[model samples]
Target: MTATTLAPATTEVLIQLRPADEWLAVCPLSRLTPGRGVAALLPDGRQVALFLDRDGVPYAIDNRDPFTGAQVLARGLVGSAAGRPFVASPLLKQRFDLSTGRCLDDESVAVTAYEVRAA
Candidate 1:
């Protein structure tokens, strides 16, 4: 669930999640359309929302609504401020950074964001 850049000399670049000891792939990168999002359940039984920005960079966050504990972050609306992409909480209209998952409304909490790349 961490995002990191990798480089290998003369090798084709591929962005992908670090393989877990018992990991599963839920959705392919092709399923995400720019400026749109898709919700999927992980193999670990967690729900997550995956988004692609206007630049086609992928981001993933927990789908759970922190304010209401509802599984609605995936249904939340997406927008930008200045140049940062954020997702609004569907229940309370709070915004969170898509890259870091930091709650814009409350600095005390943050959701998990997974590292996403073209793979």
Candidate 2:
């Protein structure tokens, strides 16, 4: 699946063996609680964090926090800012946009936002 990441020209596809339309299924929709997140490992060993908002909207992003390089985004707090959903990094408290994966505090940097869906 296609994901929006920093530097699209240099972005790498981690799950190569799977078909383009398929992504590693993290969990069932019912298993994801609101205001929380879950982490799933890709075939390439990279972890992707999946978040479902209180309103039942799903979002996916790289689990590693760019600032501290720790795999902890799934433990972040979920909330909304100005009607836009976001998650606060549990370590440094940096807020990230759920739909875009853009760090709200620093616009220059961002994590990868995966293409996800609930079936």
Candidate 3:
């Protein structure tokens, strides 16, 4: 019997964000670093923080910090609390949930959490 060899598979993963009705392609999946974030400017001049978890899950949230009014969420520290992924602001150390964009320290405050996908 002859042996068959199978070719390796290759998939080009892309990261996308939906701020409004249309989905915007930000960058390739390779551009993101696990446990870190990068900032991207939307078409409407809004800044967004993009992250890829160690498990390859992508998340996007507004880069603006409502408490300090600073656009610095991308530089925040990425971590998990109670199985929920969050990013703690570098300046004030307030944690924001990556999926919901809700301030963990303050329930009444929240930022815009964009729909993110890796495809």
Candidate 4:
């Protein structure tokens, strides 16, 4: 029997964010390391934090920390709690749910969660 060869996987996947009506390409998926995040500046002057989970799921949220008003969420640490993925603020240590952008430490506080996709 003859053996068949398969094409090598490509890191051409692009991470996109939908801040408005259209989806904007942020960066290549390979640029995002699992459990780490990167910051992207939008056309409207808004900053967004993009993350890739260990499971290869992409998430996007407002980069600004609601409590301190600092744009440093991209530098936050990512992990999961109660089966929900979250990122802890580097400054205040407050955890924000990556899916919903809700502050896990405080139910009343939340940030904007953008719809993310891989294209």
Sort the predicted structures by TM-score, highest score first. Answer: 4, 3, 2, 1
lDDT of 3: 0.94
RMSD of 4: 4.5
Using all chains and alpha carbons, the TM-scores for the candidates as numbered come to 0.77, 0.79, 0.89, 0.89
TM-score of 1: 0.77
Per-residue lDDT tens digits for candidate 1, residues 1-119, read 99998786664433354335433455666677777678887767888888888888878889998889998887778899778899998789999899898998899989988876665
For model 2, the stretches where C-alpha displacement exceeds 4 angstroms are 1-21
TM-score of predicted model 4? Answer: 0.89
Q: For this target, which candidate reaches the highest lDDT against the unseen true structure?
A: 4
Cα lDDT, all candidates: 0.79, 0.81, 0.94, 0.96
Worst 10 residues of 4 by lDDT: 9-18
Candidate 4 residues lying further than 4 Å off, grouped into runs, are 1-11
User: In model 3, which residue pairs have backbone atoms overlapping below 3 Å?
Assistant: none
lDDT of 2 at 3: 92
Give candidate 1 misplaced runs (Cα > 4 Å).
1-24
Give the clashing residue pairs of candidate 4, or none: none
Least well predicted 10-residue stretch by lDDT in candidate 1:
14-23
Clashes of 2: 0
